[model samples]
Target: MSHAFLKIYNNKRNKNFFYKKQIIYIKNIIQLLIIICIMHNFWMEWNNFKKNKNISISHIIINGKKHYSNDEYIKKTISKILTTNNFFKLNLTIIKQHIKLIPWIQKIKIHKYWPNILKIYLTEYEPYAKWNENSFINKNGDIFILPKIYLEKTVNLTFFGPLNSQLKILTMYHTMQNELKKYNFFIYSIRMSRRESWQLILTNTIELKIGTKDIKKRLNRFIKIYPILKKKNKKHIKYIDLRYTNGVAVG
Candidate 1:
């Protein structure tokens, strides 16, 4: 009888232990559910706050060299974008795309200040020379075009060359100009033919026919002979042919 009683006590003890373990697991699950509900409520409240806050952009500051009268247009564009978008969700890439539509602007930087301010920085292309007939070349050899009004006001040496030769022509022009400047000579225009032959018109209206090969050597030859030619009444000299190996032909 004692053994049977002990067996019943062991069964009760095992059942009590199993029940305690199940209770602990259920309590943990309940706590996890409560924490998850609290997180969900907090997220919803934060989103609601963002939606209801007044984060509209009220001030826009443009900072850069205003080389052209395009500030009004830029301000108009920014104002149009603000009409449909909130400051907190402004798409800077979109703004940049719109701003780049202006032809003269070379580089741009956009910034956003806290709550209600937007800032823009701009850099305009500095026109270095006239390219072909309708475009301008910057000091960096980049080609761009401006309106007729702006172009009329610009006075620069014109460069003519085959298509896609802006950088080559600009580089050669600078090299030749530096060499010529040592002798007080100034170039008014430069032209490169489709055959790659180069030529220049001096500011004094004299033309230089520089053939394709050995161009710099030929230029040096001309520089060597220029003093003697100037002594013989420079007004009578129309053109100088620098294509020969041992001598130059004057026209």
Candidate 2:
């Protein structure tokens, strides 16, 4: 009976020791986990604070003319984006994206001015030329639909082509305009056909047809002979075809 009691006592003591060790290990692990989480959270908060230290925008300034762009429209767009924005503590990328959605904005630069002011520098799209009856194109050959306020504005140089052909046509138009400027004949519009043929209408309602091949050469030839044609014939000539290699045909 004494031996059995001793054996039972030893087994109970061993079990107690094993349970104590497990409990201590679990407690230590939980404490370590809590300390790690606290450190991580502290680091995250510190980083956030560093990135956005300055808060509160005192004044907002726009530095540019509002010619093609609507002032109220721009202000409304900014107000929508700046709900939680402070001058220096803003998500600049998001702000820029929102600003760019205003269409008329060609480019924009935004930054905080000292203590509590935000300044935005803007470059708006000027109406370089008209694309058609309703839209306008900038100097870079990008077409945009202008507001009704600017729809009736005077834009003499118009361009027409297939949807993706604006850039090419604009380039050719510029070149031809330079050649025609000496005679005081500014180009009113240029159209490129599907066959790559070019037709230009002058401001005085005269048309020039430059066929697909050797366009510049034929145009130069016609320009050379245009003075003689005007002096020889004062009659109304509708269109001048510069496709012939040796001579030009007039209608």
lDDT of 2 by residue, 127-197 (tens): 88888667888888888776777766657678888778889988888888887887687888899988889
| All candidates: TM-score | 0.72, 0.66
**In model 2, which range of ten residues has the least summed lDDT?**
80-89
Residue 203's lDDT in candidate 2 = 82
What's the residue-level lDDT of 145 in candidate 2? 72
Report clashes for each candidate as comma-separated counts: 0, 0
Q: Native-vs-model 1 lDDT? A: 0.86
The C-alpha local distance difference test score for the whole of candidate 2 amounts to 0.80
Model 1: per-residue Cα lDDT over 1-251, one tens digit each? 99999999999999999999999999999999999999999999889768756567778888898777477789897777876788778888888988888777888999987767889999888888888878888989888877678775785589999889988898899999999999889998999999889999999888999989887798899999988987986577899998888887888
Top candidate, metric TM-score? 1
